[model samples]
Target: MRTHFIAIGGAAMHNLALALHEKGYNVTGSDDAIFEPSKSRLQAKGLLPAEMGWFPEKITKDIDAIILGMHAKADNPELLKAQELGLTIYSYPEFLYEQSKNKTRVVIGGSHGKTTITSMILHVMHYHNVEVDYMVGAQLEGFDTMVRLTEDADFIVLEGDEYLSSPTDRRPKFHLYQPNIALISGIAWDHINVFPTYENYVEQFEIFISKITNGGILVYNENDPEVKRIAETAANPIRKIPYHTPEYSVENGTTLLETPEGPMPIEVFGAHNLNNLAGAKWICQNMGIDEADFYEAIATFKGASKRLEKIAESSKNVAYKDFAHSPSKVAATTKAVKEQYPDRTLIACLELHTYSSLNAEFLRQYEGALDNADVAVVFYSPDAVKIKQLEEVTYEQIAKAFNREDLIIYTNPVEFKDYLFNLKPDSNGMALLLMSSGNYGGLNFDEVKKLV
Candidate 1:
């Protein structure tokens, strides 16, 4: 197969390009600007575009397919040429579906926890030598590539995101999968730019549940009221399995899972992670992994990257970084860290980076998100707000929305860095958490290590 990609330097786009290239397909791609990791990875695989900008001439008649990435604009020249040639164009998820249509597609969907759950399932399958095609959002320890498409795998596990598919395809990416097996971890209002209203955002998940194949299975988190309600009301003719937070205890910083055999100590901690693990276990069982094997493999799984990842640790201070930008995720992460180290003084800093988090109207959702921490700090860049073309937000607006009079807020990166560096953590234990989809204006982690 000969495939060409428009805006292929994206995280998902680049990974898919590499996967197709690995599958022996002649792959070529173009992008206006490519950043680190994606830039270097594509270069290593010889898949990086020769020059940065799109060349309409590259869209030829002989090309078998064009995979579109969300990064490309609707009026991209290459896309126009592809359309002019009447060539088959597929969005990233559409192409994924085309490749795995013959196999059992297990899609994990939710506002959050989808990445961690999908990673856990893949990790267990790898541990048990269960060969399968897969696509997950985050980079895992054992996986070479985030995406794998094969001719012989009986199943394909997909990390189904509710975000838009592409510039041309406005439908949520997960809507195209039409899975034979699916899981919805939880639903919280997000992507305010696209959905506009909470009701509109939730309708996407309802559509996702309806897309599950006949006689399929849906594994959901029973503990989440919204997820449980959605799973029950759906009229799909599928067997529904409900999972809740499993029995566990955090002893001296190590989290132990209560298993039928005995207490199993695991590397990952937090109630949200444990809930995700339960959902992954149900999906793994449906994929042919027995209970004993699932627990055994999961015991060794660390976690997906950037989901409560420990970046710096010491006797006096421990710091973590996470990809949490929404209100629900922010609250869960803050509570998780504080619970794990009850004796420590938790100082949490959140970067309001994503469109939803930075919006003045959306600010109220985070009213008590950082309440678990002893001291809460929120950082956002006015330049970022301008870049996203959002309405300007003031310090008073943020402070009022969070409803915490004692909260510290920073709009300048330099001042934020100064506050972090000047912190005088005593010999008493202290936990520091940094949460955002983007860095706090490119804050240096090396300097963060000196907090102790």
Candidate 2:
């Protein structure tokens, strides 16, 4: 089959392009701008476009399929040309469903923890020599690519995201999966730009649950009230299984998970991660992995990239970086770090980079998110707000939204950088937590490592 990609430089799009290339499909792609990792990987696979911009001539009648990416706008030149030719255009998720329609699909969906849960399942399967095709959002240690497809594998594990499938497709990506087995870790209002209202955002998940194949299984988090309510009220015929955070204790910065056999030591920490582990265990069990084998394989699982990843550590101070821009993620991560090292003074810093985090109305959702830290700091660039076309958020608004009188706010990157570099640890050791989906305005992580 011959497949052409409209905007192929996105994280997920580039991986799918590479997977098709490896599968012996004649794959070609075009993008306006390609960033690192995606650029280098595509170039290595000989899938990178000859030039940067899209060429209408590339959309030929000979192409069998056009896989559209979310990065491409509706009026994108390649997309427009493809439509003009009346060629079949499939959103990434739609194309994935077409490829794996024959296999049993296990989709992990939630506002957070989906990546970690999916990664854990893959790790356990890989360890037990169970062959399966899979797609996860973040890069795992053993995985070569974020996506894989095969004709022989009987099951496919997908990290289902609730974001829009493509600019032309208004449906959420997970709605197209129609999974044979699904897991909803938790529901927190996100992607404010797309859904607009909290109720509207939640309705997408309800639709996703409705899309499950007949008599399929649904594994959900029982601890979250909203998730519990949704799972119980669902009218689908699928069997519902609820999971909570397993018994675990953090001892001297190492987390030991309680198992039926004994205490299993794991590299990952935090209550959210423990909860993710519990959900992954259920999915793995349904996929033919036993509880004993699941615990054995999960012991070696470090974590997904940028999810509370330790950047630098010393005897007195440690630094961690996390891809946590959402309100719930920030709160959970902050509390986890504080709990891990109770003797240390936790200094939590967050960068308001995403459209949701920058919105004036959405800012209030972060009330008391950083309360666990001994010192709370927030940083955001005014230029970022302008670039996103969002209303300007003032220092007072942020301070008031967080409802912390002692909040430290920085609108300038220079001042934030200086504050970080000059941080001095006192008699009580300090733990630094940096949370954001973006770099702190070009703040070099190398310099951050030196400080720790």
Say which candidate scores most in lDDT: 2
Off by over 4 Å in 2: none
Give all candidate RMSDs, comma-separated: 0.9, 0.9
The number of residue pairs in model 1 that clash at the backbone is 0
lDDT of 1 at 163: 94
Tell me the lDDT of candidate 2: 0.94
Total backbone collisions for each predicted model: 0, 0
Stretches of candidate 1 exceeding 4 Å from the true structure: none
Residues 1-452 of candidate 2: C-alpha lDDT, one tens digit per residue: 99999889999999999998988999999999999999999999899999999899889999999999988999998899999999999999999999999999999999999999999999999999999999999999988999999889999999999998999998999999999999999999999999999999888888889999999999999999888998999998999999999999988888899999878889899999999999999999999999988998999998999999999998989999999989999999999999899999999999999999999999999999999999999999999999999989999999999999999999999999999999998888899999999999999876788877
- Per-residue lDDT tens digits for candidate 1, residues 1-452, read 99999988999999999999999999999999999899999999999888999999989999999999988998999999999999999999999999999999999999999999999999999999999999999999989899999999999999999999989989999999999999999999999999999999989999999999999999999998989999999997999999999999999898999999988999888899999999999999999999999999999998899989888898768999899888889999999999898888899999999999889999999999999999999999999999999999999999998889899999999999999988887667889999988878989777787785
lDDT of each: 0.94, 0.94
Colliding residue pairs in candidate 1:
none
